[model samples]
Target: MKKQLLRRIGLLFFLFAFANAKGQSLYEIVFEASDITYKAFLVYFNEQDAYMRIGYTYKGKYNVVDVKYQSVTGQEDGYNYLVMVGSNPRFITNQEKGQSYNPDHFIWVWNDQNPNQLPYVTDDPNFDASHLIQCKSYIEIDPKTMTDSYLRQFFRTDEPEYQALRKMRDASAGAINYNTSDNNSNSGSSSNNNNNNTGSGKSKMHLLLVINTDIGDIGQSCAVDQKAMEVEFREIAKAVGMPFEKYIINGEKFTRDNVERTIKSMQVGNNDVVIFYYSGHGFRWSNQTDKYPQLDMRYSEYTPLTEKTSLPLSAAAKAITDKGGRLNIILSDCCNSDIGRNQMTSTTFMASRSFQGAEIQKLKKLFIDSRGSIMITGSSPGEYSWCNINGGFFTLSFIQALKEEIGYMRTGAPSWEHIAENAVRSTQYKAKNCNGCKPQNPVSAVRVSQR
Candidate 1:
């Protein structure tokens, strides 16, 4: 089956290239609202190639010539004869002349006996002529007079007929006309130069995953965060249609310098969705500053109090702001040691840390003031972020939320706010079930003005 398909494809390409080289005038006979109701039938004719490609909307899917050398013979009586190319796999290995041939040397004979009967081809009772009975428009196209842009518009634009079919065709072919290479790069130079968005017209959303599993204080062999998070991260990214660059930092590798370098490597575009996710140990300084509250990066060369081991959370907001990203999100599945930041003044905060607290309010203020981004944390201040053999509870919950929230999206991708709501709910549920685990409620600082 594959061989036959490839052979037909090769023949089509050869025909197109050959006709173009010979300066042959290619004409397309288009019928609007013809046999295919509310759709268009485009038949291409090349005198040099003596072949035509029949493009049709069949069963709501656009299929253009799956077979080769289908004949369309027009007679002097203004009637046309068609012999559909047979779909057989053996034609690939066997190039016998009988596969396609002119019937009866283009002979035409009139038998007066068929005057009271329908055409022999339409004798099949299953054939439906209800749609074929109407003819809307019959137009001929000259490829020479039409610019490439005009030709594309003539076939694709002008109405709902061919517009949908053209889009379907482009999507089925992996959107080869669009450049998606920039999605892979982490460097600033790889930012998209093309002004156009993706084929779906949605802004390009990029993700940066930072997983730091091993805390040197906890034996390296015992740390299992990297493997656990990566599995779910990939699944979530695939479902959301977002491409990501991942960094797995373990043991002494999770240093402030390394984190800064990774953060600096990213370049977000103005019309892009940028997300940064970190899963590991985290802590706020005992003397936290409002301008730059630092989170301790677990397991590095520096001691606990040293600046080399601490990462400023503001850096993330700054990086995203520097690139003028439209939507920015930061997720930290880690713990903070400062209780001052996590003030439980409200009954809601005391009951469930996931509820709005001083910590969340401060973070919200920080982000809105800095870059108008959103922040989600796995646990409230002074609470430990729990993890089992599978992975961090918060990360797994976030992934689960993504699956559910993304499923609900009728069109395009889910908003970050929706995802955060689901994640917090799911995380609270997961934390409730774990025995001996403190009630860990994930919290978020969302800024609606950014949207």
Candidate 2:
């Protein structure tokens, strides 16, 4: 009887250990401006060690497994580097398993370079290959092991094009000096230029312009509310003490050539905050005809709209930054205007690269080195940007927030971060309530002052 009791106890202990080994907790770590801003509740035990998965939240919805990190590599410096394996596993069907099994979609060992420490490698490169199986986008890790004491790292294979793009972005961002003085003047008038001094060694102004192209037949197709946007822009400018201009593209009065010419002629210089606002029909097309998919920016146009006449984001950003300005803010409120567009066609070119007849090839690099500008957009690639008819949600919220900031409308003012936060929240709320309008995935690409 004693032997049988001991045997039973041992068997129970083994079962418990086995179950623990099979279950792991899921953790979500979000990084913004060098800090970990958000973390999700731990997801407990949904997969095995042989197979790994990662889950994250999108908007307010939980378990948005669209972008999965097959393996995670957590380093000492609070950077939760995500290793993108492929699209979410739930989207892959059994018949597609053969194609999914390709190593191109797998997460391998991370190649971290450390001058003072020894390099770390996985126990077996083939470990992932052996356990290759389809599972939902959830990673199973022991909760106890996830404590702050453990240092983890993840590896991801980077695509050539993606790597190149990231390199370009990083290079561009690195060119600017965020710590540079904002006291330099560009008004070209001695009295007004004297007024441009930054009292506390900080920027005299921070500008944000949100354009909603909802009016013109083409603009309506882009889903921008032009009138609402204009009202919001005018109000924000009035509050911020920045100059404002309107561009009517559909009418012959303001042709694309005229708009481009006006952009070229602007006299922007250091200490002057310049903002370019556009709300109109915009689309992306492939540089090569052979590409499998092509993205089109469709608007209800009485006249046919082509890519050649449209203003590209890259070009607009570069144009503002090139004029020696300490800071340039380009707020584009158009649908599908994010960075990942199909390659540009002959008629269409990247705004960032065009230089608009300027000789600068490395405009991003120049802006980054000089710390000249930042680009914020309404949505990411393949997403629709919306406008609220009642009142331009993004524009209205931005204006109201700025109005609260004292000294802004007046000659002397103190800037605050509340203005940015309020604008983001207002748009988020609007995106959530509007039908056919997904959450506005606003992306800020900048090399600005850390403060």
Candidate 3:
């Protein structure tokens, strides 16, 4: 059945391709209602190449195509048949003698033969000739008149539908300001700061990874937000001087083998900061109950976990402290991420102190004596991390704050304190505006180097 369905779909595609090949001269007309400016363009396929002819529709005429070829231009005589009859029409005529022309052009066509067609063109059976309008235009080329090629529009009107369509097209053509930079410095600093910071090793290297384990068990809004956070963080890291080696794993391209490989390749030194972030489902071992209780770390209903999916936080902390690095910044976006209670119950004190279960400590740190470790988290124990699909509240504000407008508010380059403050502010704002979700709580802690 599946094979038959695939064959049918393939056949339909071939038929549609053939239909498009037959009617290749149809063009698109665009008009702006406000300015009363109009454009008409023909998109067609010849041989295997698709071409377009664009012109303006002025005073009920189109004057667009600029070139013309005589009959004796090519090797073929009248047999050439003027394959294309428009201004600036591109002609491609390479096909086998008996083969039909098939060019790559997308168009929609309707077949009136079958009334109960399962797949009909336009996807509407009620649409008929009355709903469609057709118009014709001419192309003129006169060398004596000094007009190379142009289209003569036959019909120019101010119909309601036409006007409405033109208005929509004009609105769509308008530019949107996706880059919300308040001043000129923000736009210029992205490149300029990168150049200045190229050789400056003043700040310690930090890799923060946040993973939300709540997704593995319960449905949480933070799962999707956590993914977006990782993407933004990676972009920020690239904008700064961090390599791909120093990244917090949050299922971006993470697998068991890749995770192990990343952990094994860690370098610990004075200037290196390694961060691990998790935001999904997390659980704490309950001694009295002798089972793990599902922590409400998400805005949705309470859901419990049977086993712990996240690495023990104590083990992770011990890994950075034992390596004697200048700084280690551990940032987690997960809720109820504390592993203190579970760590004390499950492992011996000596084993817990060592970086046995902790995977982030394997990096080779490369820093001097003047840096300290920083750990930032989305939420603390018994708190929920909120997320909305529209955007990551914490991350969006954090990035904006580091941007020129907010960063320039202070005297120097953005510090971790500034970024954290911005993230918290943004998260709170989003929580208040969001309908169903609770406020997101972000936490930060730093461990300085004694050396």
Candidate 4:
């Protein structure tokens, strides 16, 4: 009976020892960044001579990492490093010598929330990737109740894992430095870019002018002042450093194919800006559930409108966006009423005044660096974009806003948002209050997709 009792006790002890040695949790480590949290497990296995393994789940797959030490140095042996394998190996650090291992000193890869933001990198040696994180993003370790002392006790300061971790950290830092340099070259400095031809620290601006002076019918006709509006647009483009090309479609030349060709030929890049100007008639086609805007390119005689005779505004916008223009401005000075006919009216108003030489100089001095598309319409849907002997109210206000200095010139060029707001307000005030003028309302829309 005594021998049997002793045998039972020995069996229990052996089973417990084996289970503990097979898979022991040494530490559950947490690394935090601004937008992501990486949870790593420091696991000890007796089968491999008590070697430590890092286990983590990435993209929903379990990754078991075998890291070799790269370095561990400090008066109190504070630094500990271990690295996985790859050309751009991910990093895991316990602490750095003579420095507190705070969450703030974390390497930020990229913003997970922002789909457009790419990783920022640099090539500067001694450059730390930790500073890449913005204040809003952060990482946190799990098992919050775990003691810090218990975690620190598992550190092997003299092991190969320490040195390997250091190597991983350096590699990540270099990648960050490289990314930073690349973004700066493309976005912040014109001299570093080959696409910015003039080295004026400004991206090239291209303008395509489309004017329709002869819509044929008297009611659907723009005043003779349409020519004056075109000239004003040319001057505004010159003042704003745009090399513009104008195309007038009055009779048979006005067609969807021609307009599509013009848009396709723009070939805008990340360092290029495009302005599409259309002055004529805007048509709205309705089929119960939908109402779409189209630019009418009517011939001299009254004829039924066909697909070849007009271009859909949506189609034009899609072409511009698809062409990858960094900044796209669409200015349409036309009637947007859905009545299937253009408003015919002659105004005594002449072309509105243009900006002064000094104002133009101020615009030339300003540098705008932004990406996205903004559309400024002459009038809202169901309203007539009034054109007088002076000019179209919408175009006039747009030009005036470009000329006026909202802030200091050196701070940077006026944002599309600022310009659009100013133009919309100015046009509304002038159109509603002007004598013998029909009520007109300007409409503006913006899409900042890839700034």
Q: Could you tell me every candidate's TM-score relative to the true structure?
A: 0.44, 0.38, 0.38, 0.47
Leading candidate by lDDT: 4
Every model: Cα RMSD to truth:
23.3, 20.6, 22.1, 25.7
| Alpha-carbon local distance difference test for all models | 0.42, 0.35, 0.34, 0.45
lDDT (10s digit) by residue, model 2, range 1-451: 3224323323432343345332112343322212212221222111111122222333343331223222222212321121222223341112233332222123212224421221111112232333322222223232224332221121122323223223333433444211111223121111111122242232233232222233343333223333434443333333333444444333332345554666676655465556655554334454433111112223234445565445566666776677666667676655553323211111110011111011122221222223445566555555555643323334444433333332111122223343455456555644543334456655555556522
* lDDT digits (tens) for residues 59-81 of candidate 3: 45434432221100011111111
lDDT for model 2, please. Answer: 0.35
Residue 328, candidate 2: alpha-carbon lDDT: 72
- Model 1 clash pairs? none
**Candidate 4 residue lDDT tens string, 96-198:** 3442221111111212343222222211122233323223322222222334333333334554534433333344333211110111111111111223333
Stretches off by above 4 angstroms in model 3 are 1-265, 283-308, 337-370, 391-406, 447-451
lDDT of 1 by residue, 126-213 (tens): 2222212213333444322344354343344453424433432343344222111122223221222223234324444455555554
lDDT winner between 2 and 3, please give it.
Answer: 2
**TM-score attained by model 1:** 0.44
